[model samples]
Target: MALRPLFASLWRLLCSLKLAIVLAAAVTLLGIGGSLVMHFNPGVFGDLDRMILGRWWSTAGSAAPLLSWWVPVGALLLALLCLNTLCCFLDWARRIRYRWRKGGEYLIHLGFVLVLIAYFWGSLAGFRSEGNRLFVGQTLALPSLPGHFLRLEAFEPIFAENGRPVDMLSTVALLHGDNLLARQIVRTNTPLTWKGLAVFPGSFGRTVEGFAVHIAGVGRTSFSPGAELSLPDGLRLRVLNFLSDARRLAGGRVARGSSELGRPAFELELNHPDGPSWRGWYLLAEGPPSALTEAGLLLRPVEPLYRPYSILTINDDPGAALALTGGLAMLAGVLLALVSFYYKRGRGDRPEVW
Candidate 1:
């Protein structure tokens, strides 16, 4: 009974419009500060996450050297703002007289509340995206979902005139053990979405696929397209041309065309890195990538080079549905509020309709 006056005072303070305005202004200022901090110190937040939360399944904290301190502060202020909005809404409802004109005001408040709820829900339950690079016949295990993996079947790169890459595509299959659940052709703009999980084709980078040479300490080095090698024996090797698709011309001649993945071949040149003193072409795919000697070194091509794989980003948003519903509800509430305000003003019942 003694706490009744204290609760009433707290409720009145929370329901104050001035408090809501102040919170809103603070949120806006914090947003501006965040943008500025991100612009100046781009990797500050990422570094903070890595340092405080570790690499995989990362979270963020205030250990960052720069401006990441605003995150928790902003979040707290936003939560308080939501509470203030809710309090104001309840206060408005309690003060309103039962009338049709008051419907618009109720709707407006409800919409704002729904929008806030959606954002809060998303912040709490939304998914952080995961990225992976997959090659042909390679399987990637899903981190978030157990007993699920995606396999890369084929990756094709479409080239325009003069061998300029235009678009890339990947055929991927999601499977649980031997059971194939879904097969999708993921492209740059076309994403594969299944079971609330969306898979998007990201960027691409070269991978040394086939002929790999195990040089002592240096894991596995392959003769890929645009590859340069500096051997420990003071010799340099450079690949001149790699033809994954080539056509045999008239007499003992191998030439590449604009179309088709024919016989794979490579034209290489070995030289001293310091100066272009000794340089000779080693036609590997034509003869033997292994049995070659221009630098007097037994640098052999152990395997073949495969097509570059595409980077894929997988995302799942649990609160997406809630966010969408809340957004639509908010919009409808705004429209209802406007209708009520206009209808009341037309009848000249009140000059200012809150």
Candidate 2:
């Protein structure tokens, strides 16, 4: 008999409207605090975008307690609010008689509960992988989808007259082993989605495709950037860097001037077994600088190849549909309730109590 009274007290507490108001206010306050923290210390919270929320709590969240302590507390309050909503809904359903007008109130409660549940589910199940670099004719295996691969077919960038990129388009194909599943042109706004996986075009940049080198008394050989070569004299030649649209700075340093190709340059490092290594920049526009001739080496640049690439972000969000459904349900419930209110007022009858 004593336990019965305690159970009744717990039930009343669970369905208390005052408890709901307090929880909502606390959640809002915590949200404001989190926003401020993120704005000032973006480096701490920035990793959350690329990680699963459930996993972030143990890693980044634990690493920065002062900034992220409110997240777990807010989540707990949300869970309590969800339970309270559910309890109030059940109490209302049990006491009130069913009517078409009352259906809207039920839907409102259910929708709110579902929205909370969706958030909780998504935080645990959803994941986001950002800044995946994909070059033309290269294939990247999907981390979320097994046996699925994303291949870059082509990339096109439209630049303004001032050399700023106005728009970018990437033609990508989704493949399963040797079979092609789907192909689409993904842009900044238009994301490709398949099997609940979304591929978004994040950004684009240029990369070195290959390099053509000519060694005197030896046949011309093709080399890629960052490749090392062994000379006949047992010297080592390393291609350290390649810059398209290269600009010569005041101190003889090279930098990328613009996106458009102007003067291509290569920074090479020559290593000798018994002597100090030599490093210098060789411009393609000017054939083999005097430094190479002074070193008694016959090396020349034939051509520099470069191409643009696309960075795609893949997102796996399983609770998106649930959230959408909850939003629609809430909208319908509000409209139905408004119509019922007007109808009751027209008839001059007492308005239904919520």
Candidate 3:
């Protein structure tokens, strides 16, 4: 048979409830296949920094990156959705013999289809995000898209110990241009929708947190290799490796090992330390001298402030809305078919004897 005939028949076959199960199964299998890879490999998280949410299916190793490959996989998944809709439309079109009952059912489903189409178009084109990195009372233009900009009313980041984030840094932003739409706060679960964009709260950035440091090595201390230090300026510096002939922080007046007592800090030997070996020792707020002198070096621990968070991933897929609408309509259409079939049979619209 011709391709059109075959497709039409296929769609007719698929219009049955069985086709929904098949599509759901296919989707489940796809998810399972992707989940297996992630379960086996622990190192994929490292690449997540470079990934765009959906690219985690294929492990790119050292190659050109998964987006070069996995994005097409995602595209294919979207294409399958078209098959799902064809079945629904075919089921409605098949009931040509009945008008009012079937037609009303069809109308409800057509409304559902409209919703689905809207979702599909909007999802593919609609962009969503929760935005702003500005401090309180500071204003920053927001953009749901490239041309859009939102002015910030405020942003806050409340945190816990070890720099673990407790809540999203809330930023109140306004529409940059004329009053097309008002502004609001977007948090996790709650999203602010304006024009075709829905901005949801994703997470907080490290830029809101204070400074931190790790002491990888103690130059001339009697302490072990693993120690952490926090600098006054708030820069978290790490010692990649130990340098030889590092200055020692030993004082006979107190004790040779007392550097671990009143002061639990590390003495840093600068790479540019000149003669007599200039070195600086920084202690915790509880330790010894605010600044200790060792050898003949004026060494100070360096602290750096937090870096700003720049980007957020926004998703606008037109298919989601369509799928939701189609789903609801499909349900109504199926129920109507069942009820109409039962009522007609019970009422004896035609006599059984021939």
Candidate 4:
């Protein structure tokens, strides 16, 4: 018999629009209090709760706290839904009295409720972030979650003349395992996405390339530092030359772009004759051709290549729908109650009947 009254009271509370409003206000106040506690105490916000009239708030009260925040959020949403149902009741009551104005007021409130629910749904699910940092030769670990691995092939940054550190770029060599994945030159605005996760370009310069030493001198030599050449048909050519922007007497002089690589043409050995063989002195990618012993040679700019990076995920929820439904309902109630008790309250079409 005692249980029956208690159940009845619980039902009445759940069916009350007033209760929903109070809780909503309480949730907001709690949020502010939480912020204040975190701001003032700094330490206690981690886990603390004081008096009740003060709007009781607690953390990790359950057996396991850190593992769940969803429970509390759900409870709040449920309370909001009860309020929505109450609003629906108000509309039903007003409609029986042919109060269209009151109904319209309630509908306006419903729209915002839907929006809130969507937000919650969006918040509770489908979101995650995880990745690792690595040097050029090193590989990135695949996330613990289901997804492919994105390897850093090379990372380069473009800087302004003043040198304040600007954009970062990564030449990524992706991988699934021993097998290669996608390879792309990634920079700002460029992202590599797969399995619902996205890899954006982060800061750069932590790689094997960072360890490279620059060597420049006035001389043409066999092979500047780069990958040694390999040929399909037969023999291969090693890059045999490079100098700054300069030339010398038949005896010797070297010129590379605008800067002299210390000295000019000294000596060079042709590494290959085909493919990368003596192309042009002013080439872009594989540098220019070599003129040593009239053998086919290639000139290459010694640019140390490397890769580095990190990864960020944006994810999707089901309960959010119910909360939205409830919120909309509650809003409708407030509007109907407001209009029926005021503006429409005095309308001539309004039945004198209470």
In candidate 3 the C-alpha lDDT for residue 35 amounts to 63
Task: State the lDDT of candidate 3 residue by residue for 17-129, as single tens digits.
Answer: 56555656665676666566656654754454433333333445334344234334534554454455455655557755554555535655465556646644653454444
User: Each prediction's Cα lDDT score?
Assistant: 0.67, 0.81, 0.46, 0.47
Write model 2 residue lDDT over 251-271, tens digit each, in one string: 987888775667777788888
Stronger candidate by TM-score (2 vs 3): 2
Q: How high is the lDDT of residue 208 in model 4?
A: 22
Every model's TM-score? 0.61, 0.70, 0.45, 0.41
lDDT leaderboard ranking: 2, 1, 4, 3
Candidate 2 Cα errors over 4 Å, as ranges? 1-5, 93-100, 178-181, 211-303, 344-354
Candidate 4 wrongly placed segments (more than 4 Å)? 1-15, 40-108, 119-124, 130-161, 165-205, 210-354
Candidate 3: minimum summed lDDT over ten consecutive residues — where? 252-261
How displaced is residue 284 in candidate 3, in Å?
16
Residue-level error in angstroms, candidate 1, position 121: 4.8
